[model samples]
Target: MIRFETAGESHGEALIALISGLPAGIPVDFEFVNRELWRRQQGYGRGGRMKIETDKVHILSGVRHGKTIGSPIAIQIPNRDWKNWEEKLPVEAGDPAKHQAVASPRPGHADLPGALKYNFKDARYVLERASARESTSRVAAGAFAKLLLRALGIEVASHVIRVGHVELERAATWDEIVAVTEKQDVLLSCVDAETEARMKEEVEEVARTGDTVGGVFEVVVHNLPPGVGTYANWDERLDGLLAWAVMSLQAVKGVEIGRGVTAAESFGSQVHDAIHYGPETAEKPTRFTRHQNNAGGIEGGISNGEDIVVRGYLKPISTLRRPLESVRFDTREATAASYERSDLCVVPAAGVAAEAMVAFIIAQQVLEKFGGDSLDELKRNYDGYIQQIRNF
Candidate 1:
């Protein structure tokens, strides 16, 4: 199975990620991975961290001369901010009284529970790893997965669906969606011109008021092959994996597949996709296609050669400037929670993270369906599956 792990702290020397189980011979792109990392730090209302750091990836190993060698890949992204924090978070233990800083507990964050569970008096332990800064490694690893999927003609993209109280003016079409996303500047990543403008206004409003606002974002994957996942086993379900991935985003409160909540209120006729077949043609004939994509490119836990649509709802950043009222961990005295520099709105950034996670899930599913020790073997297996589907 294809899997990955990332280790490091928010303000440590560097963040490291290890990804394995990729078939050999798959060519990887370093520039694309670095670009994705850079995208994650963008959007309006981002805190001072973005100004301090320009994220760039260093590929340690796993491939030679641009192609995968069928081994685990390792990547590192240094924290430029670490220079200042070296004494605070030293490689070796430092003076506790002078350097150690504790927070009573921040409302709407992992601070309290994590500190209590780990027996840490300080909330720093919770915020360090819990910070969305960790998504940097994910972006690095997931961008590689996206390259693999792209080689197989699968494409994934995401956009902000909401920001603060403003929803999008309308859902975007495939071509229009690509055009908007291709723009170099990604303020909010919202496709709707009018709504994104309104959202940006709201973000500015919130920042001036020292408040934060949360919103939602959506991702879509197109041109996926059918039968990549299985319905036979509950654990083999593709939708479950996608949901798990989307929900794993930091501050993500919910996930939606296809029509999602809309399906609950509608009749079966409206929810189910209608399939059609036609005569075989020389160019693209006999290949079954769908009139609708209500299942989000999945049926019975497997891909159905359609577009996969996933959505995520991100909560407000927990480390608010206007902190919430809470009791101090040591004295039990009522006071405001510790303050931290945080984004006023992160829907656009969350969309970036969502895209990475979605790509990772799809990569894992593809590897499971077509097991190969090398990329050439994997490609052969994939071609065979396509031929088999055409024959069917």
Candidate 2:
């Protein structure tokens, strides 16, 4: 079984990840992993933390000279801001006077509940790890997952779809997305120029008022062969796995596959993708086809030889300079919620994180479908599955 876990606090020396169950002999690209980490720290409305940390992955184990040996892969991303925090958050016992304390819970953050659950008198402990800074490590682990998927000809990418009140009307093309995303330099990382400009303006407005905003992003997986997910088992549904991962991201409230909630309002005819088949081509062994794709490339919990599209809806950041009215858990006195250094909007960055999660889940699903102790064995199994389908 493929599994992964992360460790370390937000202000600690670094974050760590352990990913297991990948087949051996897959090439590992350090630069690609680093690039993903770099992409996660970007966006027009990022806060001081982004300016403080330049993410880079340190691969300590699980590969030999950049190829997987099949052992659990481990990665570490050092907290650049740890220099300033070392004294306050020292690993050893101290008077606790030097540490950053969070007495007030941010309105939308996990602060209050987490504190209550863990019996923490203050929320500082909870927010330190709960902070989106933790996603940096997940993105690192996902970078490796993407590398493995790419080896099998699977490709994943994401872009901002909507920012606050502004939404882009058209879907971006592969070439258009690749041309710019390969560089990963733009702040909004949006394909529509005007929409991106408007998003930046909105961020400026939010920042001016010390408020936060939210938006939506879509992650797409292309060039995936059919039968990579299972319909026989509910647990093996790829969409379920992908949704869980996306929803785990901070501020993400809803996840959609293909048409999503819109399907509920539509008649069956409008919601379902009809099929037609014929005219076999070199690229298509079972006759080139696809009358519609409203199902979003999946049927009965398995891929249908079409691209997978999943969009995530993110709510505004919880931390606000202009605090909301609330009472302290201990005193029960009316007061403004505590404010923390935060972003005005992070949908662009969230897009990158969503892609990481999508890629990781898809890669895991692929592994589950085609098992092997080695990359060559994995490829053999995959080829056999395809041949069986073609001959059927």
| TM-score (C-alpha) between model 2 and the true structure | 0.96
lDDT of 2: 0.84
Give per-residue CA lDDT, model 1, range 60-145, as digits (tens): 88989989888899999999999888888877788675564656788888888999899987888788888899999898888988
Give the distance in Å from residue 242's predicted Cα in candidate 1 to where it truly belongs.
Answer: 0.8
Worst 10 residues of 1 by lDDT: 278-287
Candidate 2 residue runs with Cα over 4 Å from true position: 282-288
| Alpha-carbon runs more than 4 Å astray in model 1 | 279-286
Clashes of each: 3, 0
Instruction: Tell me how many residue pairs clash in candidate 1.
Output: 3
